[model samples]
Target: MLVTGGTGGLGGAVTAAFIEAGWRTVVPVRKKTSAESRSGAVGRGPGSNRDPKATPAEGDAVYVSADLTDPASVDAAVAVAAGEPAAPLRAVVNLVGGYAASGLVHETPIEDFERMLSLNLRPTYLVTHAALPHLLAAGGAVVCVSSRAAVAPFAGAAGYVTAKAAVVAFANAVAVEYRQRGVRCNTVLPSVIDTPANREAQPDADHSRWVAPADIAKVIHFLCGDESAPTTGATIPVYGRA
Candidate 1:
């Protein structure tokens, strides 16, 4: 399994869920933080970590330094994930994205819009493109994390809305292209995720309705498992009453 952005708040929960489920998950992180100094598997690339001192915790996933935006780096991380013959790369969860509310469309700069597109879509495309071969080798699944805003658009975030909608479209396209090839792809549309950053950003808002990271993680875990074998090209909304 390859989980991009497995170092962030929601990503940590996703990684933990996969580990708890006994999958030898592979994580592509920008930098190996102190918490991940003991990364198990190491891959070779421009920004990849090859230090031998790294090791996996009891049931932790393999952490590889990678720049998801870079094709070579993404390929390196996928290689590490598919390295183990016993546990072939069977799943890929693309959670690498950001949300920014600069202003209305007229108030946002072209650079800001392009940056949102690059940040949200580029990594997902690169990682999935690099891992397709391995996923095709054996039956596998791909889960992309979009947002409720993609469907229920809000004010002041045109770039974010467009990028997330693009993600859903991309996932659906992958699903259609690979349906007969034993590769399933789906998208999870989460409402405002309950994370520390979101809480801090909307300190006065009602946090109770926000979806928990663990809750979403469980949904993602289920999507990649055998139970969802019949599911594909689906956009499952994970809005927690928000």
Candidate 2:
């Protein structure tokens, strides 16, 4: 498995969930870290934001260093996951995106607009492209983290919304094109996934009602597993108190 953006809040939770579920996850991280042992430190770091109202998974997790945006880094990681022919990659979960500028198109500079698209959209396409051969061979799955902002209009975030919308649409189209090859694809449109970034942005909001990363991880794991074989080209909404 190839998990992009494994250093973040949701990515860590997703890693834990997959490990607990016995799915050997290969997180393509960017930077190096000293905190390596998740089997012992499991649920220690960011589980502080766990959902009080939701059930959580249990298990250990592993990590690998790889950058998503850089093509060489992407290629190197994907090669290890799928091209190796040793540890075949049966799934790819794209969690590489983040919120962009929250301003009107005119107010948001071209650099910011392009940066948002670069940050949110390109990683998915590049990683997906690199992993296509392995996906085709293993009949793997791809789960993209889109947002409600992609479909439902949000104020002062035209660039962000448009980029996310493209991601959702891309997943659907990829799902259709690759379905015949036994590969599945789906998009998760999360309303407010509880993460450090979100908490920092909306400090006063009732985070108790916010959706946990593990919750999204469970949904993503399902989408990548055997149960969702017939669930390709679909968009799942994961709204919390919205």
Candidate 3:
């Protein structure tokens, strides 16, 4: 299994879940130091104070340095993950995306709109495009993260809304094109994930209603398991009462 954005809060949870489930998890980080730190600290909370150099538990995780937005970098990451003789690549979880709140559609610049698309969709497309052949060879599964804003849009984030919606569409397209080939693709929509970053961003908002990273990670892990083999092109909502 390969997880992009695995150094992040949610991604850390997902990577740990897969590793716990006995999958040889490979996480791609942008910097070597980031990868090194993450390899030793999978699933640690944002507030963790553990020594960064401490050795991780056996079979904790493997980290590779790659930029998802770069095609060559993505390919290199995939190659490293797939090269594992005992556990060839069988799953890809795309958590590499960003959120940007802009003015209303009329006030938003074209560049901002394009930037949103590039930020959210380009890495997804590039990584998936490069991994398709490996996934096809192994009959694998894919899980992508899309925002609730894609379907339940609010004001002042036209670019973000549009780009996230496009992500769902792209996942559906992949599902349709690869279903017969034993490859499944699905998207999970989350709303206000309860991460430290989010709490810092919305200090006054009620955190009780926000979804937890562990909760979403479990859902994603299930999607990649055999029980969900019958599921594909599904847009499952992971919103937590908000």
Candidate 4:
């Protein structure tokens, strides 16, 4: 399993869930230092040590340095993840995305709109494009993350809403293109994920209704597993209580 953004709050939970389920997880990080630091974050559960230089001597999870937005870098990262012939790459969870709240369409800068698209969509397209051949050969699964705002939009975040909606559309396209080849693609839409960063961002919000990272991770893991073999092009909403 190759989990992009596996070092982040939600991605870390996803990586840890896969590892706990006995999958050899490979995470792509942009920097060697970030990879080294994330080694401890994803290998274990949330709130684990985050030492900038801590390196696990041996573990089921390994981090490879690669810029996900670049095709060459994504290809190299995929090669490293699919290194062993015995254990080919079987799953790709694209969690390499971001959220930005900007003004209305007229008030937002063109650069901000482009950045939103680049940040939320480019890495997913690049990584999935580069990994399709291997996934086709292995009959694997592809999972992407989209936001609830995509379907149920609010004011003042036009760029984020549009970008997230594009993600879902891209995943649906992949599902249609590869369903016969045994490559399943699906998107998960989350609503206000309950992470430390989010809590800090919205200090007074009712976090009890927010979804947990671990919960979403479990959903992603299920989508990648054999139980969901018949499920493809499904946009599953993982809004916990919210």
Q: What pairs collide in candidate 3?
A: none
Q: Is candidate 1 or candidate 2 better by TM-score?
A: 1
**What is candidate 2's TM-score against the reference?**
0.86
Off by over 4 Å in 1: 38-59
Worst 10 residues of 3 by lDDT: 43-52
Best by lDDT: 1
Q: Over the stretch 1-242, how does candidate 1's per-residue lDDT look in tens digits?
A: 99988878899899889877777778887875555544333432222342322333333567788999999988998999998887899999999999888899999999999999999999999999999999999889999999998999999999999999999999999999999999999999999899999999899989999899999999999999999999999999998978
Error of 2 at 147 (Å): 0.7
Q: Model 3, 1-242: lDDT tens per residue?
A: 88998868799889878866777778888766444555455432222243333433533567777888889999998898788676778899999989887798999999999999998999899888988999999988999999999999999999999999999999999999999999999999999999999999999999999999999999999999989999999999999988
Order of models, best TM-score first: 1, 3, 4, 2
lDDT of each: 0.88, 0.78, 0.86, 0.86
Best by TM-score: 1
The superposed Cα distance between candidate 2 and the true structure at residue 229, in angstroms, equals: 0.7
Candidate 4 global TM-score: 0.90
Checking candidate 2 for backbone clashes, the offending pairs are: 29-66
lDDT score, candidate 3, position 242 = 80
Q: What is the TM-score of each candidate against the true structure?
A: 0.91, 0.86, 0.90, 0.90
TM-score head-to-head 2 vs 3, winner:
3
In candidate 2, residue 56 scores what lDDT?
30
Off by over 4 Å in 2: 37-62, 83-86
Those runs of model 3 whose alpha carbons end farther than 4 Å from true positions after fitting are 34-59
Candidate 4 lDDT over residue span 1-242, tens digit each: 79999888898799889877767678887765444555455433322343422432234466777888788989999997787575689999999888787788899998998888999999999989988999998899999999999899999888889999999999999999999999999999999999999999999999999999999999999999999999999999999999
